[model samples]
Target: MREEVNMPLNLEEKKELVKEVSDVLLNADTILTADYRGLTANQLTEFRKIARTPGIYIKIVKNNMLKMALKDSEYAVISDKISGPQILATASDNPGEFAKLVKKFIDNNENIELKSLAYKGKELDLSEIKKLATLPTYEEAISMLMSIMQAPVQKLMATMTAVPTKMVRTLDAVKGTKN
Candidate 1:
C-alpha cells in the first residue's frame, strides 16, 4: 500500500488566501461559482489563460477556505453551495460582461458546470444567469443606445434639408427652361 503525502497550508498561508479572497469578493461586481470537476490539467490551463482578461479573476478553493472568506461578505448567501470542486470567479466589470465570460467558459468546457451567480447582493438562479450572459456588455449597450438616439436626429436633419434642396433644384430647372 502506498502512503499519501499531504502538506496542508500553514496558518499564515491560509490567512493570506482568505484575506485575498475576501478582498476580491469585496471589490467584485459579480461572483460566479462553478464546478470544475472532470476537466483536464491542460484544459484548465487554457481556460485560465482565456480568463486572464481585464476585470476577471478565478480562484479554486476548498469549501472551508471559501466559507471562511465569505463569513463577512454580502456573498455569504452562496456559502451554502460551496461544497464540491469549485471555481470562484470574481469580476470587477459589469455583471453582464462577467456573465459573458462565464458563459464562454461553460460553452467551451463540458466538464465545467455552472452553479450559481451572485450579483447586486442577490443570488441569481441558473436561468437568470443565462439571460444575463446573453446581454450586451457595457460598451455594446452604450453604442446601441447612441445609435438609437442619433438615428432620429439624423433623419430629422436630413428631412429638414431635403425640402430646401428640392426647392432649389426646382427653381434651377425653371430658370434653365425659361432661358
Candidate 2:
C-alpha cells in the first residue's frame, strides 16, 4: 500500500518538535535506536504500554526531525543510524531495566531491528545493547555491591560480640557454682 504523505510541519511546529526531542536527549541516562517500520499498530500500542513505566520512554520519530533535534548533543552520534524510520528508546535512571524491556519486545518480533545504543558518551552496537540488557538493574547492582562491601564489617561485629557473650556466660557459670 502506498503511504499517505504527511503534510510538512510549519517552522513553529518543527522548532517545538526539535525542542521536545532535545529535552529527551538531555534527560535520558541511556538512549537506544531501532528500526520500527515493520511494527504493526497493535504492536506499537503494546510497546507504548510497556514503555510507560517510570524511567522508560519510547518515540517513533521522523528521521529528518530527529537529525535537526540531535545536533550539538551527545545523541548526534546516533543520527547516522536515523537514515530511515526509527524507534528511539530511553531510560532516565534505569538503563538496564529499559534495555531489558526493549529487548524483550525486539526478541518477540522478527521485524524489529536494533540499530544503535548510546550511554555515558559512548555509542554501542546491538551486541553491546544485548549485554546491557542482561545487566542487573541499577538498584539491584548497587545493593549487591553494598552487600559484598558490608560482609567483612558484619563478620567483625559478630566476632566482637561473641567475645563479650562468652565472658558473660563464664561469669554466670562461676556465680552458679558459688551459690
Candidate 3:
C-alpha cells in the first residue's frame, strides 16, 4: 500500500527563500505590481515573452511575503500597491523600457491590466505608465533629431549648385561695362 507523505519546510529553508527574494528586490531598479487574475495561461506566457526580451523578470509572490521583503528598500514606493494574486515584474537596469513593454502588451491585450508602477522609487498610476509606453525610446528620438537637423544642410547644398552660372553672368556684365 502507498503511504501518505507530509513534508514541511524547516525554518532554515523559509529564511533562505525570503533572503533570496529580498536580494532580488534590493537589486531591481523598478518593481511593478500587476493583477494576473483574469489572464489565461497562454496570455500570461505571451506577456512573459515581451517582458524577458528587455531583461525584465516576473515573480508571483504572496502579498505578505512581498510586503515584508519590500518594507525597507526602494520598493517601498509601491509597497502599499501590492494586492492578493499580484505578479511582480522587475527590471535591473532601465525600468522605463520594461514599463513600455508591459504597457504595449496591455494595450493590445485589453484583458491584461497594469495595476501600478514603481519607477526609481516613485509610484506611478496606470495612465502615467501608459504615457511612458507611448513615448519613443531614447535612442529612437535621438535618431529623429539627427535627421531633422540634417535637412538645412541638404537645402544649402542645392542652393550652392547655381553659384557657377551666377558668377559667369557677373563677369559678362563687367566686360560690357569695360567696352
Candidate 4:
C-alpha cells in the first residue's frame, strides 16, 4: 500500500491566502474563533451552510496562516484564541445576528466549543459573547424605538377620545332609563 503525501502550501499560495483572509478581516465587525475538534465532516458542512449569509464568512485554515492574516489587523487581538483545529467566523455587519447564529450552533452541537470573540478591536469572553447574541437586530431595534416613541402619542389620543365616548354612553343610559 502506498501512502499519499501531503503537500504544503507554497509561498505564493500562502501570500494569497493571507491576503484573502486580511480582506475579509478588514470589513469584519465581529470575529469569532471556535474549537471544532470533535465535529464530524457533516456537522462542519451543516455549519458552513448555516453561515452562508451574505456578509458572514467561515473558514477552516491552519493556525499559522490565520495568524499571519490577523497580523496588523484590528482582529489581531484574537490571535491568542487561535489554536488546535479552530474555525474562523466573521461578519461584516449585524454582529449580533452572527453571534446569535454561532450561539445557536453551539447550543445544538455539543462538540463545538466557542473559544473567543473580538468586536471592534476588543476581546470578549464567552459570557460577553452570549450577551451579544441576545442583542436585537437593526430593524428590531428601530421598531422597538418607534414603539416607545409612539406610545405617549397613542395614549394621549386614546385619553382625548375617552371623554366623548363616556359622555355618549351616559346619554344612551339616561334615554333608556327615561323610556
Task: Quote each prediction's TM-score.
Answer: 0.88, 0.80, 0.70, 0.90
Across residues 1-179, which tens digit of lDDT does each residue of candidate 2 receive?
A: 12556776778877787788888888888888888778899988888887789978788878888888778677788778887788777888877888888888888988888888899657887788788888899789999999999999999999999999999999999999999
Name the top lDDT candidate: 4
Pairwise lDDT winner, candidates 2 and 4:
4
Ranking by TM-score: 4, 1, 2, 3
> How high is the lDDT of residue 40 in model 4?
94
1-179: candidate 3 lDDT, tens digit per residue: 11444454456756665676688877787678888888889988887786656557787667877787788777776777778688878877655677688777777787765677777778877678766666666677788899899999988887897698789899999999999
TM-score of 1: 0.88
| Separate clash counts for every candidate | 0, 0, 0, 0
Error of 4 at 40 (Å): 0.4
Off by over 4 Å in 3: 1-17, 94-96, 148-179
lDDT of 1: 0.84
Per-residue lDDT over 60-81 for candidate 1, one digit per residue giving the tens place of the 0 to 100 score: 8888999999889888988988
Scored by lDDT, model 4 comes in at: 0.88
Off by over 4 Å in 2: 1-8, 161-179
Where model 1 places Cα greater than 4 Å from the true spot, the runs are 1-6, 176-179
- Model 3 residue 142 CA deviation (Å) reads 3.7
